[model samples]
Target: MAKRALSVLVSGYTFLEGLRWHEDRLWASDFYTGKVIAAGLDGRVTEMAQVPQQPSGLGWLPDGRLLISSMRDRKVLRREPDGTLAVHADLTALTGGHINDMVVDRAGRAYVGNFGFDLMSGAPFRTTGLVCVEPDGAARVVAEGLWFPNGSFITPDGRTLIVNETFGNRVSAFDILPGGNLGPRRDWASFGAMPDSDDIGTLMAAASIAPDGGALDAEGAVWVADAIGKRIVRVQQGGRILEQIDTGEQGIFAAALGGPRGTTLFMAAAPNFAEHERRATRLGQILMAEVDVPHAGLP
Candidate 1:
């Protein structure tokens, strides 16, 4: 991997996450702004939907409707062709934690993850589960005992699903069984073992890797936004760091491979994830860099 400067696509966002490329547009959710946005190559921005509680992930259905994760409310909102937002799936009964990010499969089944603990309040670590929501709105927990499953991506063939466990310091892979259930699990990459400390500050300081949001490339590699490392990394199946881009002092919470040929790597950057501090300023931005491989698979 080579070190280089990333170009700024847009600025003045409160906080951005869940970046994706669809229908020639770049979509993402701005947590503090409470809006899901779409931007073009020209940098023109559009508000696609509003998520009052907080939005962290974005995806689309096979029929072209949009799916956005409502973080605080523990629900997934669907945007119809007419632009009205409605409860697509309710995940409240599946977990005691808040929902965070998701990846909708080709059949319109969505795989979602959660916070596992009260992050903003500094609660100790609590294991969480991943939920699968059918296209018709049925929901169920498919996997359990995960440590903060934050970002996810499905392979081009839709046979494998890779999820980034932020606090777990690894990216886990699962076989996508028929009807959206997860099969056997294995570590696709492991930066280190789970931290020994339960305290947030101690765990963060001692942690060597924290894989955040991610996107898959055509070459079967995943580009990850490592929040604690303050950089984006390309990882292979056996935990290899093939490429890396330093983000200087900023924290990259999420990333997506976009652009006409899908060679553009888009990153959501901020100084930190503090809610109050992010809402107080507009320092968040959508940063971009060119990569050799184009994007592949689900967002």
Candidate 2:
């Protein structure tokens, strides 16, 4: 297939992280602002809710409730329609690192990731892994030895779960059982390296590592945030780099399948953390774009 092009729809955000298309609006998390913002097709932004701790991932359950990952609190929360947040699951005991991103299945099972260690300070810590949270809130670690697991998604057929290991610079897959257990882990795709001529070195920066969030397109291509690269990469099922969508920003965090027909791709881009602290960029901006393909998996 020919490579699909990505056109920017919108920009300017403070460390955007998670992206979800609910109803007719596009919803996302602002990591630094601790708030969720909903964007309409007309480009209107509305405050959805405020999360006390930093928010990273977002999902919805079968019951129509919103699931939010409170990265700092080490817990998954159920946000009711009335604006109250309940403890969906506490993951601190199960995960050695901080929760990062997640994907919820049709049965309401949420597969989540962790930071693995202190990235900013370059501190050593135990390797992180993926955890499965049942609909009733019970949770367990299903895979380990991952280096900063970030964006993830379940295949449309519901047979495979793919997760991006940020620090490892690779995407991994797992066999999905009926009861929510992941098995037989293996590499799915790899983002080789920053151009050798660039000064960032072999590893991408904190926002890079295929960062915060991603979504699958109709052709089964994985559209990853590629945060550190300041772009989005479309990876096919066979591990091929199909296309790259540059957001024209330093800290591109997450992307989602949204817009009128679900073919439009919405990205959350922001200035670097240091730049944000210096008031050099707006805290939260929803960058918009339209892609050639539609979303493959559930929104």
Candidate 3:
């Protein structure tokens, strides 16, 4: 891991997460601020939408409608072509915790994950599941027994899916079945053995790599936000760290690769991830660095 020269694209946000590069701009859910914002390389910024219940993951329907995860309400909101938000799916009965990151495929199926426990209030650790919501608003649990499934990615061919288990210290991969169900789970990258603990703090303390959120690169490696490591890492399969961007005092939670040439890497950075710290001070920023490989696969 080497310190690299990073550029600040924009600043003043309250905990940015679920970042994605789309349509020549980077979009992210400023969760604590309850806003979905978009920013471009030209420095233009826009408030795309607002989610009162707190927005997390973001995706798009087949018809180009926007899908936003309303975390507290346990629902997925679809921004219609006319800009009116509609309830796409209610996941209250399916998920146990606050829904977070998600990735939608070409066919408009969203793969979503959650916090898995009462994070801010401090609850015991529990393995959660990954959910799938169809274009028509049908939803179901596609896979189970995940340790805080945070960010995910789908291959461009729509065959493989990758999920980052932030507390599990690994990235998991699954095969996409013909009908959108996941076949089986396997380790795409294992940083260390799974912690035999039920406490969030204990689990994090034992983790060698907290794979939080990331984007898949053209070379098949993932640019991951090493949550507890205070840096952004490019990790290859089987737990090999290819590169790292030292974020220093700032903490990175998500990364996106985009720009005219797709070489600009954007990160959702904050001083720390504490809920109180973010709400009390809007120190979140979007940081950028240049990478050799362009982005590939669905966000």
Candidate 4:
């Protein structure tokens, strides 16, 4: 496939976290600001709802409600039609670490993850894998001992689930069993070694490589937000980097494929996370690129 260049859609955000395509709007989250926003196809940004804690992931329920992962509270939330957010499930007791990103199935079952360790303090904590949450608020740990799971996506056939191991520098695959439980874990893709950095501790660059989020394309390729590399990479199913689109910024937290034709690749980028803390800059922004391939599964 031919490589394409990235284009800036808009700029000036606090800290872009999640990117999703729902209905005619592109939904996203600003973790630092605790705000979930909906951007129109015409580039109009509007506030959808605000959560008390950091919103990490976005999903839709069978009833058409919005499902969100509240990172700080370690819970999954549902936003009703009246714009009220309610706790759908509390995962504190099920997960050994803080919840991160998630993916929900058509059956309304959500697969959630934990940091496994503290990211900000560069400290080692507990290791928790993946958990499956039902609509009724029941949860079960389906996988374990993953190194900081981040972005995740289920295959169109609903037979496989792929998860990005942020700190581990790899993507893992599992069988989607009955009732939305994950089967045995297997390595899907692995980045050999992490880049060395003095400022970011002995942290593996591979872990933070695809830090925040990513999406799957129509050709069965995984489009990952390579934060450390300041680019978005399209990886084939067999683990080859097919294309790379540079962001020209530091922190590229998340991405999605949306637009009128569903071929527009939307990237959520920002300067270094530390920069947001310094001046409270609206540094986070959403950028777009017209790719030849369209997004495969739900955005």
Could you tell me every candidate's TM-score relative to the true structure? 0.97, 0.87, 0.98, 0.91
Q: Model 3 residue 115 lDDT?
A: 81
Please list the residue runs of candidate 1 whose C-alpha ends up more than 4 Å from where it truly belongs after superposition: none
Q: Where is model 3 poorest over a 10-residue stretch in terms of lDDT?
A: 1-10
**After superposition, which runs of candidate 2 have C-alpha atoms over 4 Å from their true positions?**
1-12, 192-202, 205-212, 273-283
lDDT (Cα, tens digit) per residue for candidate 1, span 103-213: 999899999999888988888878788999999899999988787898899998999999998888788999998778998668988887765766778767766778889
Question: Per-residue alpha-carbon lDDT of model 4 for 266-285, expressed as tens digits?
Answer: 88887765533723777778
Winning model by lDDT: 3
lDDT of each: 0.89, 0.75, 0.90, 0.78
What is candidate 2's lDDT per residue for 172-230, written digit by digit as tens? 88999868898878878765543422222335552234544678887888887775677
TM-score of 1: 0.97
Error of 4 at 215 (Å): 0.8
The predicted structure with the larger lDDT, 1 or 3, is 3
Off by over 4 Å in 3: 1-3
lDDT-best of 2 and 3: 3
For all candidates, what are the clash counts?
0, 14, 0, 4
RMSD values for the candidates in order, in angstroms, are 1.1, 3.8, 1.1, 2.7
- What residue pairs clash in candidate 3, if any at all? none
**Candidate 3: global Cα-lDDT?**
0.90
